[model samples]
Target: MRLTVLGCAGSFPGPEAACSAYLIEADGFRLLVDFGSGSLSALQRYAGLHAVDAILLTHLHCDHMLDACTYVVVRRYAPDGPYPPLPVYAPAGAPDRIATAYNISGESVDDVYTFYGLQPGSFPIGPLQVTVDRVNHPVETYGVRVEHGDRVLTYSSDTAPCEALLRLAQDAHVFLCEASYLDGVDNPPDLHLTGREAGEAATKAGVGRLLLTHLVTAWGSEASTFEAAASSFDGPVEIVRAGARYEV
Candidate 1:
């Protein structure tokens, strides 16, 4: 499996990076995780948007799902004409909410792309097997563990350190977790994780690699933050900077 970091900034677009978005490709299938603000441009530059097969949204936050609605329009009205239906996976209640937000009719959704709302559990999606788990967040959110053949990739989405996250990512080849705050930043009771917490989770879960994302724009150099986080884990720990790629 190949992992591409289309965007990695937190909250909103930064000078160097966009928001949260990732492209994972394996076995001729491409899956996108979170299409945040300005992600389409980065995706087009990195992983061709036309090559996308499916999109997995972690939540409805503006930095995660905002671009999804616009992307549908772009694909449908492309000069080359509309392509086959693309599969979009999301947490429960996403279809109705997003459809209303996008002003799309259900009848018009005939295959060119369809939304599949997932409950909290394991399920199959195309050639990729997925395990979804609820996470500690203000809104209804889920983290996904995607498996293709013998390779496994787990994404924590946007969540505080939670047991479900550890369970979903345990022993995975790659753990794409969110570190939305710096060490000293005082986060609210149930919001996001700090860099150290992310590292601790990856170490406890026995993840092969810890790839940190969703970093606050004020977090300074990603390399420095990741180095600090790595102090907690013996395994490989690195920040997912914009335009970075990893072969997982």
Candidate 2:
């Protein structure tokens, strides 16, 4: 499996990064993990606007899902002609949230993408084995675990430290985790993870690599974030860039 970071900035977009999005590909199938604010523009850099085969939204938070509304416009009005509806796996009420963001009714957008409600379990998407579990977050967020053959890729959508996340990411090749708070900050509980917390989880899960993301400089320190993760986890660690790609 191949992983591409379309956007990784957290809460809001950075000057050079979008909010939160990732592209996972294997067997010629492209699965989008999240379509956050400003990510659609970044996505066009790595693949065609119409090239995405399916979408998996972690939650309805604007930073993680707002651009899906923009995607409806792209697919609905593309000059090449409207393509077949894409499969969209997302949290319950996703269609309504997306439609409301688009300023249209849910039924109107339903024709553009087939929506599947996400739950805690495993399923198949194309050639990949996919699993999702509820995470500790304000909204109904989900962290995804994708496996193909012997390789495993897990993404922590947006969450505080939780056992379900660590269990889901066990032995993963890559753990794409969110670290929105700094090492020494007194962050609130059940909202986000500090960089140190993310690294500790990766260590406990025995992941091959830890790619920390979801940074908002306005609220957290970026340089210190990486430092904190590195101090806790003994593995390859990086604060993912907007277009960084990795093989799993």
Which candidate's lDDT is highest?
A: 2
lDDT of 1 by residue, 145-228 (tens): 999888889999989988999999999999999887777656686788887889899989999999888887674556656766
- Deviating ranges (above 4 Å) for candidate 2: 104-107
* TM-score, one value per model: 0.91, 0.97
Query: Which residue pairs show collisions in model 1?
Result: 85-111, 85-112, 85-113, 86-112, 86-113
The candidate that achieves the highest TM-score relative to the unseen native structure: 2
User: Cα miss at 219, model 2 (Å)?
Assistant: 2.9
For model 2, how does the per-residue alpha-carbon lDDT over 132-245 read when each residue is reduced to its tens digit? 999999999999999999999999999999998998899999999999988766778998999899999999999999999998877778889999999999999998998899
The TM-score of candidate 1 is 0.91
